[model samples]
Target: MKKHMKLFSFLLALTVTASSAGCSLSGKKNSSTSSSVLSEDDEGNEGSADGAKADEKKTDGDIRPQDDFYGYVNYATLKDAEIPYGQYGTSVFMDESDESPSEKIVKEIGKSDKKYAPGTNEQLIHDIYAQAISYKDDGTAEKEIMANCDRILNAGNISELMSVYGDLTLNYGSPSIFQFEVMHDYKDSSRYAMYLYPMQSFLGTSLESIHDEISKCEAPNNIARDMFRIQGDDYDTADEKGRQMVYIGMDIANNTDFEGANDMGHLLALEKTSFEEFDSIFSNLDVSLIDVFCADAKSRADGLYVIDRGQCEKINELFTDENLDKWKAYIYSTYISSMGYFIPDSSEILSDYFPKSKEAEDDQAASVVLNYLSKQVSEIYTERYYTPELDKGIHDMFDEIIGSYRELIANADWLSADTRKALRKKLDGIKLITAPEPHKVNAKDAKLVGSSLYESDKALTRKVMDDKLELLSSPMDRMKAMMLSTDVNAQYLPCNTINVTVAIMQPPMFDPKGDHAANLGGLGTVMGHEIGHAFDSNCINFSPEGKYDPSWLGEEDKKILDERADVLTDYYSKYTIMEVFHVDGKLTNGENYADLSGVECVTNILDDKEELKKLFESYAKTWCSLSVDSSGIERLKTDEHSPEKIRVNAVLASNKKFNEVYDIKEGDGMYVAPEERVSRW
Candidate 1:
């Protein structure tokens, strides 16, 4: 699955109402005890009357709020801020959650003298981490990679070439002409479906983007030439080959109908067809490559795949010997790039190609293991930190936030009776998945234990693939947790489910004993934001059954939604980031819409003036972050959500409640005039 599977909005919050007195609680265990827990007593050190004052003084430095709210709230820290080594930014919640738990887990597992139980999740993580730290850069991996490249380059015919292509893609994570995968059917939302789309380059950049860069001038080609030089090519020859390969990428991008700003969101909307129909259009070329990725479903895949007929036809016409040769080079380069760490002289060869981070390869490998074996990590993380009390507190907080959303829908004047009823049903239909389900390891698989790391990792990937292929003929597991409980994030699945990962449930993001005001500001807002996605412009029309059916919305209500959404687009588009790039308001509209609804919902829950003040301050500090200039620009270009600064200030400015709580006067940075402010509620 693509890393973009997580659909998140900007989220932050504070504690509950004052009426819930003495509701002190501790969040998940972390080393930073200073602010991890809160006491409900009046004289408690944190989240007390004095605690709120301390936060105001700590954050609201000398800068005038009217001139710059982000600077005002964040300047004192930003002035002396140091991005953590090997990281772009840090937060109290993020920093505490990141290192302490994972590092501790690794340390504990590493100390074990005996081998972990065979075929258990513990065995998998232990082997992967142990192998990573002890990895020796021998010439063997490079030789294997070169041997595969040679096979592709020396193929005798289209059938032979395509077979080699299939092996690389299915086992080695390389892509040939196109890619195939099994995922939840968008049209049905309750069953698995097969999708075939144009192949994406292994390089971080997409084909269209890479091609555009090469077309600009010789700079991109010169860079590619350097990469090839590292692979043993002389300068001039590498330069020529680099330019030719880029042109090949351009041709593929053009032929695939993904020439400009293409993403899965766009491809999902394109015309879909059965595998038989798709292959008929490409009969001139061998199309059996599809079966290689589909595994056991080879025969059953007859009419299972949904594809873009136009793109397939164009790709079929473009598959000639000359183009195939260029493809070989392209694929070889990408495959080697992916395996750089495993190759000899990998550091020097890849130093210029990949970012320079202070982290060691072993640590990166450990993270990879954690990600791939998230179910295991989730189990360990929960056992050590998650408690029944924290679980109940979080669920209660979620209910409170959802209550606010329900009130908003109940009172929405813009929604007609029919549209409002449909919207409410859709909202009520949303399911909640908060923790990772137990992973049932197969003790019977020999490769699960007493195998080399490389072999074990390969087996794991194949296992995951086989499971997905099996889903092709089975029902979708809608309640399955898609993320590790240890990840510090929440998401709204389009399948009418909200996933609150266990990691994000920890403090300072969501404090149990912390001021309900602060918890409301941080976690409450997050819950509201995630739930708000169901009512966002794109998702508002989805049926209660989770199907994307715009007919659920009345024509008049749809018009109102679009108009309000445009307000958000115009408002956010004007905010500049890094002095050069502006937020892609249109791209970020859905998230921004959620942000508005979230903050508004949280604000509606507040009644006490002092508590409200604390919530506003807590909300602002949650978004307090400083990033490298280059990273900021990259975020503006690629991130669907607005920059952190814009997420804080733009969101605050949109709500009248923020102004009332903070006494944000006319011209204040936090004040958006009534006419300019866009309130989705």
Candidate 2:
């Protein structure tokens, strides 16, 4: 799967009314406690003093309320309630005594003949299960495994593969496809087995090399040091480093300049020139010294590795003029809709004047919009929950989770001693990139000079790419240029130098006062989800030293994980939006895994008795919202993440900790069978 799979959304909750008479005791309140022993009457009957039921009445089994104020509930409160009860609430729509909102939606969708109509929900659900089962049983599994291996094996060339033979041996062969083996063991153990690999091995160099270079240089005290060199600073001071950093930052900013204003005299002349002319200029340049320095810098970053000229050329080859335009459209749309970065939609102009032979402009437009929306949601979350102080808290939570795995490793009855030792080493080598690295573009110092929007954008893109290329050449160091800017809205780049740029920090995604549930539901989930990617199925195959190693878990444990994932795929497949829902369970499985796991991880931390319940309530409030539009609904079909409603339902369903809080019972509609639940840490 692409690194794009790392981004996603989160949960839902119920409204809190002041009236005691109208409120359903079985709703939000029941899930808030650890005790699950409650009767149907106990479930309902909680209204505020105002006499209005806190739990709004359901119609056609849809728990969503008619009133806009009661439309969507909070995630934190829902989690608080569910964490103790193990269900949404005693009276959730998914309960056996009640039909789920989705089931009702399925019934409604069934009435429509349009492929994308609302009635196809049930079929969509059924199809996802069928597909998942097929993926597991058909030759698809082998094909997928092989394809991934090929991607890695062919990343650079045969020489690179030979250098990482031990790593390749574990994952490359038809018979010894190591990822499958790990999955097999997880299936048997009901526990996750991850194989950690180093990013350097695949990229053909080590991040350590890059890190050493950065260490030799001083750190910058402010953004200026990164932009230009200054005197009187320590060798390791930020000011000295700032000069190189500024150059890279300016390069990216300039490339992004869509307007023509930033174009230099020479660049203008080259713009109208042929590709051959451009190539000539590039070839004549003495970039070797810069490349060497960049390579050194990348080594210092710890997790990043250089993508050699050969690989860069290959990636470049993948970009045709048409594809480049599509990519630009996607980026622009993502900025506008998701990141809330205000950019004019020139689709009208493109559609009217740009030749249709250019590409599928409509598809590009939609994708761009979707990316923007996703990013917008992410920013909302970052603004609400991300802070320097909270960083340590989050890290500590991760440590505790890791500690649990340690205990599990020690006591596992099935694993052989050899496997255990290997697992321990993998655990020890887990590489974590918290927050952005300190060595990215210094936006403050970078000036855009393009005269036209298009020119500026192109210039900025090229500049950014060059800066990144420079970093890739250097050793690994965490770059926070992206994170420090409140304007950045998304993240990408899979190597050791994790890049979180400023483009990801924008609105709809990051409103300080936006409802907590929605903010976290958007960006918080995304951030945590991305962090989870560091240890996702694909990343887990490598070792911390950037080498490929197949020593994470034993065979038995891998099986358990597959079966568990199967359950998730099966369950999500059952969800339908209009009758024509397209839940691509196989394609989305990795994201689903991350979403589920992130919720579990975050919930474990938030559920502590010592934590204030109100904070949980605030978190729950984030997921609350009004209904979406037809276009928004249509987009859900192709989306990798589950719809908001299901995101809450599926996660809470499998959370045993939630069951304890909600008093959810076996055979309840929202209940997940114990044997069917998937747990990966």
Candidate 3:
């Protein structure tokens, strides 16, 4: 899976016009165009139910455009549109497009009553969906939910609590104290390695944010208390218990040495330690947490773990017997929260505690069904939409984009010979996976079999965990694509690989018959954006061979890149969203830098005046979106990428080519002076 952060722009990360302020999932608008803008009526505009009202849109000459390009192009278009797919952007539309295979499969599954045989992939998919939507007749779902709740309450010690939490994560995909996954060895990106990450409660939010009112804490502690109270506790007791849970969370944040946890630091500062050393350094969490939670990890020939020593040390502080009450309270709260998924009656409580969009609320059952069956659904989608020609087209476009990057790097004046060589080596080594490979559910050890929805879900979870555990001792297969081909997204994995799924390669994003301008604007730009990640600030820690190495860039070259990035930071920091929410320039610099590089790469490949103009228009169109909603406000704080409107406007503002093509003069909405424009490519 792509990391929680550091995603490429497009699909979810990219923008484009919608029917209203929020993004639309389906469209019925016809393609409309102007010399300066591509209207929603253009090709691929089929069923989008988002974007500004056609009557409300001011012609380019009707009004005085602000120097704020994003405001001029995107802000006035706001009309509080509905987010049908629950998310507000191109990603939603891409996933729900008429051509979307997953959507088709979901609809197909929803209309079917065909019984799948046990031990088959279809059966697993059916069971996951049936259980998710509460359509299963058996009482296993209720039992499953209660059983986990019982486990939490039954934990008599901190060690036992840790074990139960791990079980919850391993079997039910619930939140836990720590998270683990099979990832490319940072030291050797070509191979798989197990990575243990501190839970989001520790890393997702800042310390100050964590200390805010219960309303501000991760999910409402008050709700957790309410759930506990409902279980049997009196009001006061439940409230105190909830407070204890909140306090433990706060303490974790307060004691955490959060000085360096940024993208670059995530790669550079963490030290690798053996399991024995891990046991000593964070003894409270070692064998109890790792062994019981992930037995395969303990038995592996390679027992190495990478950790931020400072963070782990603080975690140790919370592990004493003296803090057992707090630990137990937190455990009980999370266990109840986890049960919310299996218990349909708990939806009301879960809704109030956890943030969710209206679409998510209304379509909860359907979304859950599709999500749990993602692998199988993706397979169905791939079978319907994927083709060799489509794959080849995207692959060819990616290669060309790489070639463009090579030319840009070759011409870069600031990079020294050695630094450029290292960069080229990394670029050359990038493994591109453009298609989804074959996937089959292994039902070899599905013990939770029967007519029980809960048992079926438990079995599915166990199977997933088993596969993950197996990866701990297995060799990484370089040829295997990590992401599903049917996924409507693209990514640049830090493993020196770029994955552009076939789903995203469809119309609107990558038109097969479209002119160079449209193709380059959409798909071409995406290719460049992903390639930029290879050399971005966060990814720069790795050498060309994908080994973790900070020496890739010489000191002088690093200074130059840093200075250039500072200019970008300054430029983006000036843009404020939702009035009070300011963009986190440093946090978003990597993606912003990639946006600039992507534009440069695309522009470098085009020479014809008409083609350049279309490319510019297409690029702008790619990021055109309606007004942003409040839900996006939180994203502004933590998301690595800036808003879609900002991505398009900011990147264009920094490009001389864009200025020339659009005829943007000084003081124009889209203009940025040559001296102020920032670019690292």
Candidate numbers, best TM-score first, in rank order: 1, 3, 2
Q: How do the residues 1-681 of candidate 1 rate in per-residue lDDT, one tens digit apiece?
A: 111112123221111111111211211211321111111222332322222333343432334433345555655654554445675544433333235566557656754676777777677677777776665546666677778868866876656677777677667655355666676666556766777756555244565555446554344355566657776888888878667766655655565454222343554465556666665776766656466545567554445544555556656665667676555556666666665555535546575555434456545656667656766767788777678888889888877877777888889976797877777787777787888777676777536433445455556666666777776777778887766776677878678888887777766678687889998888787888888888886677567776767776788889988998997888778766533456788888888988888889998898898897777767767776655555566666667777766676677766776667666555333445677677878
lDDT for position 47 in model 3: 20
Displacement of the residue 325 alpha carbon in candidate 3, Å: 3.5
Please list the C-alpha lDDT of all candidates, in the order they appear. Answer: 0.63, 0.35, 0.62
What's the true lDDT of residue 61 in model 2? Answer: 23
Candidate 2 deviates by what RMSD?
24.1
**Candidate 2 to truth, TM:** 0.41
Score candidate 2 by lDDT: 0.35
- In candidate 3 the C-alpha lDDT for residue 152 amounts to 75
Model 1 vs. true fold: TM: 0.81
lDDT of 1 at 402: 72
For each candidate, what TM-score against the reference?
Answer: 0.81, 0.41, 0.79
Ranking 1 against 2 by lDDT, winner: 1
Off by over 4 Å in 2: 1-462, 468-472, 475-531, 547-556, 578-582, 605-622, 625-637
